[model samples]
Target chain A: MSLQEVFRNCAEQRRSALIGYLPAGFPTVSESVGLFEAMVRGDGHTPGCDIVEVGLPYSDPVMDGSTIQSAAERALRNGFRVRQLFDVVSAVAASGAVPVVMSYWNPIHRYGPDAFARDLRAAGGAGLITPDLVPEEAGEWMEASEEHRLDRIFLVAPSSTEHRLALTASAGTGFLYAASVMGVTGARESVSDSARELVRRTRAHTELPIGVGLGVRTAEHAAEVASFADGVIVGSAFVTRAEREGQDGVCAFAGELGRGVRTASPEPAGG
Target chain B: MTARDLGGAADPDELGSPDSGSHDPDEGGHFGPYGGRFMPEALIAAQDELAAEYDKARRDPEFVAELDRLLRDYAGRPSPLTEAERFSAHAGGARVLLKREDLNHTGSHKINNVLGQALLVKRMGKRRVIAETGAGQHGVATATACALLDLDCVIYMGATDTRRQALNVARMRLLGAEVRPVSTGSATLKDAINEALRDWVTNVADTHYLLGTAAGAHPFPLLVRNLHRVIGTEARQQVLERTGGLPDAVLACVGGGSNAIGIFHGFIDDPGVRLIGAEAGGHGLDSGEHGAALTSGSPGTLHGARSYLLQDEDGQIAEAYSISAGLDYPGVGPEHAWLADSGRAEYRAVTDEEAMEAFRLLSRTEGIIPAVESAHALAAALRVGTELGPEAVLVVNVSGRGDKDMDTAAHYFGLVPEAGITGEDQQ
Candidate 1:
């Protein structure tokens, strides 16, 4: 299914979409595929995650915290290549979840954006979420994504001005990634107060789904974010859980977060 | 005479070709195929603002006058170009000259870049400055400048470097800057940069990220090179007056390629003068434990710019090792990569053993102790000198003093006493 379809389905169900992230080839290539499969299909309790963001590991993950950095390091050490990202994506997409790629821009540039977008689309991937690429420098990627009919997701940070927020919202297609904190990606104890304000400001520019990420760690945090956001994106938390609990741990944790998104009281329209 | 008078005109672009415009980075911050603004959405505006401000500051007469005054009165500019006669006998009898950047305030050419950026921070109305350092020379310089300007300063150093260069860490603290030790990602220069970038993004409103070297994103490579261009300009005129002509070769150590680019700028348009850069060949290129990015690396992007980098087959950046902390980086400045690829400069790798020998040779022969980083250039000079013969005139940029490298030098040479320690503890 397309990323838009996934969000439409979540909106129909009166629940925010649950998006889980895992670096492809972490621990091992085959094991990461298994972990991703678990993230898509829950333990027969709540609905499985709505979307999966397969991380294409880069050498310097400047936006990542230690958890994701170590995971990426392990993945890179285990001979994770960009081609292996397709394998992970194909498996996750086969399980009926939208698989989007979250990568730094250099790998795509180095790997050739057109070829990467073509290969990813052929592998049933939905789109790309470039953490470090802004709208101004994304012309090449935008053309490639357009050629492949892939969604180009861009980020809107809490530090973004209204002008920047508008520019990003217009440039983005799949969903607008709203960073919940001003710092690098980590599971913080409390979400910044600015996140909600940022989401509100971004909503003034576009009607597209806004997914909140970077600091959401627990079911409670996910539920809190889901009260307002259209999607709840969890990355380092899933990687950390998968590190300790394996695939079953990923399912249990993702299931709980999925339940949280379902149980949260949605905010009033335009509130 | 004032120090500025000894250096001729202070116009940075005057020494280079007016028609070529070779020194300026293109509008997109690219130097040929290397360098661009590969950054997050949050930093595009900041980077653009910096690039614009730097463009204005470079052309502003008042800004130039103020910076020239600081370079003269505050940071001790017009550092001497000394003729190393005694040391020349070992370099195949070549006439060797040393650009004495070690004589500058804070004991390194880093002062040149630091003062320029600190002045820009003040001009931007930012009250706080943050920086990342590996060997702590850049950190010390930044802290010194911040203290002089009364700007709040925070320096990030890798946990490993903080321990290895504890004296420098103390010096930074004494300069009233907060030192934060980053314990992530190989615990080195790259990690410190990551931490500093994080700080900059988080505190973009009131802080300026004072990047030390010529590597990182846009405006930095151009800004840093311009700030330190005086090294090459002064050395060029001094060499001309001393030798009646340009040297056959100009050599400097290349980590992030700041010192080398600084010295190379004056002679870049002069096709006759060979520009040589010596990189750290930690153990040896064959041993796979080295930081010879230009010699052993491929074109890749790291730390926000496309540059030659040591990486694995899958494009993961590999850890670079060198006895000199400053030279132990996996990536080179994008402009250096451009220079190497364009045939404007030649780069060679000098092994740790060779650099140490050069370090010892310079001290014993000329009574001048060189930083281990600079010793790489000295080792390269020895080879290039022998190849060029006795009539060759060469200028080597002594990028920093060896005072901060005593521990490493003592450890390398076994200069410690029976107690396995040196200094006041023995006294």
Candidate 2:
């Protein structure tokens, strides 16, 4: 499904869905895939996640928090690689849930973006999110993403100015990842007020959806953010829960977070 | 961290090393397999031009004369080679020699590399210099050079490091270099490296990347080590003159491998002089708990080139963990890799426990508190001295003073003396 379609569906439901990220092969490659399947089949792996963001691991993951860092290490020790990441999308596809592969530029550039886009699309990936790949330098993959009918999502932090936001929004297809803070990705005690302002700023320039991330971890954090954003991206936080508990624990944690946000949804008016 | 900790020996335009070819990187800046034109294609010629200019400056008699004068008058060069009789006495009667780099203006061998690089950057017409630092020692040294040169400087540091080494951070700002906190990735030295590289790439037009150790893409390792060799060269001469013969062994700590190579290169041809490197064995070598790149790491490419790297089964780089920031990395200089493989140097792993013991040992016995990084070498010296017996003489590179590491040491040793914001407490 297209990201726009996902956005439309969320708009109809009046609730932002969960886009959960687990570094591909967080505990192990086989387990990573099994986790993806479980999350989708409602077998209780990351329960209630509307979208599965299969995080492709990189040697230097600059944006990760402690939880994600540990997960990446576990996955890396299991020998995760760019070429083999497709198996994850394939497994997630088999379970029939939204697949969004997140990664850094080096791995994508190294894997040949065109080939990667093709492979991901073939494996039923819905979109892509790369924190390191800026639009100016993304010609190599931006075009390939379009060709493969995959959404090329981009991120902008609260520190980004209006001009910068407009450019990011203009270039972005799936959604503009509105970062809640100025620092690296992680769960923080509170979300910045600029987050809502950023959502408004992006809405001024583009019709593309805005998804807020970084520090939006708990169900309350997600619900609070969903009130202003079209969607919420939970990385380090969910990854944290995944780390503290096993896959079952993450499913239970994500379920609470997802249900919490969904409960905040306004009821539809009856005729 | 801040730059004041790097107070140094020479002026920015005129560093301790005379514009001698001893310091210039070749046409594109290199020393053996150690140097190369590893920058982007656009910056390649710019670096070459800088290298050529350095060559011309080296040949200039006036430049040589100025460097010589500064070496004598400013840096207090020919830093004493102290004979550690008391410590040596503990060495089972083996004579222990020390290259007193701790006496250098900045209290370490780091000044040698920074001064040379800062001088070259000025000659190359760069107005600003940037560096990435871990423990803030190299940053202080670089800041000192920039302060002396009046060059605009910026240092990238992981945010976590700033908190742990706050005094050093303040020290840098005092020296007039801006400290940029890197909040990215683990908030450690590696992230600082990434941020610094980004800064270098973006500001290439007016900036020079002043690398701290014998690592990086090319020319950096070679350029840095060559500048630092003066430490070994002087020590070697002093040791020879004092003892009337070459020491049985020369030992130094290995981080990016510059200091070890600095002193090692001077004695590379001296077959009789045994060269030893002590790496950070954080916990224990048995549990894969060390930075013994030469001993445990395999030949692999990392940072910028092929070298001895601590990697996993699939060859992915493993995060280097150590009590000392300087030694927290997975790779070493290519030259050291060659040295290790060729069996030219004997490398050993010294754990934090051992290094701490040596730190305390040196402080109590010699009244000389040495940096934890340097303590590895001291511990090795202690071990080797005991093994070699009474007639043997071992020279250990006291790379730097332990003042900067005072807090860490105190905390680690459970010597939690209530240190307020006192004048004496700060490094």
Best by DockQ: 1
In order, what fnat does every candidate score? 0.45, 0.03
lDDT at B199 for candidate 1?
83
- Worst 10 contiguous positions by lDDT, candidate 2 chain A: A262-271
TM for chain B in all models? Answer: 0.94, 0.88
lDDT of 2 by residue, B124-201 (tens): 888999998888988988899899888999999889889878999999999998999987655777778767765654
TM-score (C-alpha, index-matched) for candidate 1: 0.92
lDDT per residue as tens, model 2, A1-271: 6667777787787887667777888788887776666555443423466777899876665455556766786777677776678888888867666888887654565456798899899988888987755564467678898898888888775555566667778888877777666556678888779787777767887877777787787878888887777777778876666666666766676677777557665322110
TM-score of every prediction relative to native: 0.92, 0.62
- lDDT per residue for candidate 1 within B27-70, as digits (tens), equals 77789888887777666667777887876776676777788899
